[model samples]
Target: MKNNLYNFTDKSGSFISFSAHRIKSLYLPLCNEILMSSITADLHGDIKSGQNSFLMEPASRADLSLSKSSRNFWVYVNKDQVWSAAGVSKNI
Candidate 1:
């Protein structure tokens, strides 16, 4: 059974709907609402992890890493900066 649902939108403003069950077998836990919702809710407020800032060119060179756990959470960063938003790119 599906634990969640997703409605995807493209840059053109078009959207498509799909059942999470379709991909659940692949073991993509990000589709699980119980897990996803908790992670999202926890990211709110004054938590340092939720606060994101841009790093300049020199600062960008410092070794940066993210845990698999954090990779599942929503985060926004400047595309041109060291840490980038999940799927955004500077060229876009």
Candidate 2:
């Protein structure tokens, strides 16, 4: 199950930028809850690990979801930044 973290638009038609903290604290917990709830009815028990199994692709699919114009203005991450988010699995 892939999840897209997009810019939330307010009711007044203004785009609201969600802080990293908000994503980590609020949205992540909600995602965890849904994932946990799904696990309960998974007959095959496909979940090998727990909630931590949820992969956070900080600069891939999520980035693509942005508007094309927005993407053009994106600052690229350096090697260290990539390592911090992806670690050894990045090579794979």
Candidate 3:
């Protein structure tokens, strides 16, 4: 959990930081949210993943439909309007 495959850090090693608290409290939850939501779609027979994902967009936290055009990807949507959250898949 200390290291991640995803480039959550800056290459120049400046202007950004992945503190242990951030990774555990923020980053990991986001990645997990994608998995949770994908599970929701998969239950209905639509598999979503990196290969079938979307670019992050300012979509409704509860918005449905993952789209793509020769470059499919899931949008990293926020979980709620009042406060940003993860584990939104449970709502779907």
Candidate 4:
């Protein structure tokens, strides 16, 4: 593998999730219910650590520096998935 190469995968969730509570004023009961209901059966069990299924927050340089254990959960957003949701891509 070469440097600068980013093989982003679910093994490493979102760094922004750390600041989940900072951005409030929304509702997410459905997500919490679904997650709790399917804990043992869920593929990624550790996701519930921070319990932030739909939280988005701005991260500072210090926040991003946190260790792996400090993270909430790992999220995998791949190219194929992106293109599928966004339709075909155009060449530059």
Among all candidates shown, the one with the greatest lDDT: 3
- The TM-score of predicted model 2 comes to 0.17
Q: lDDT value for candidate 3? A: 0.32
Clashing pairs in 1: none
In candidate 3, what are the lDDT values of residues 1-92, reduced to their tens digit?
Answer: 54452344567743343343332212211245454232122121122444456454333323323332112334455755232132233343
Q: Flag regions of model 3 displaced more than 4 Å.
A: 1-39, 43-54, 65-92
Instruction: Tell me which of candidates 2 and 4 scores higher on TM-score.
Output: 2
- Cα misplacement distance, residue 32 of candidate 4 (Å): 11
Cα deviation at 70, candidate 4, in Å, is: 27
**Model 4 lDDT per residue over 1-92, tens place:** 54232333466642223333343321122235444211111111133324454233433333323312222333335653322221223321
TM-score of 1: 0.15
Per-candidate TM-score against the hidden true structure? 0.15, 0.17, 0.15, 0.17
The lDDT of each candidate is 0.29, 0.29, 0.32, 0.29
Task: Give me the displacement of residue 7 in model 2, in angstroms.
Answer: 6.0
Choose the strongest candidate by TM-score.
Answer: 2
What local lDDT score does residue 36 receive in model 3, on the 0 to 100 scale? 27
Per-residue lDDT tens digits for candidate 2, residues 1-26, read 52354454677755444343333222
Off by over 4 Å in 2: 1-7, 10-16, 22-24, 27-82, 86-92
**Each model's Cα RMSD:** 16.3, 15.5, 14.5, 17.1
- Evaluated at residue 38, the lDDT of candidate 2 is 18
Clashing pairs in 2: none
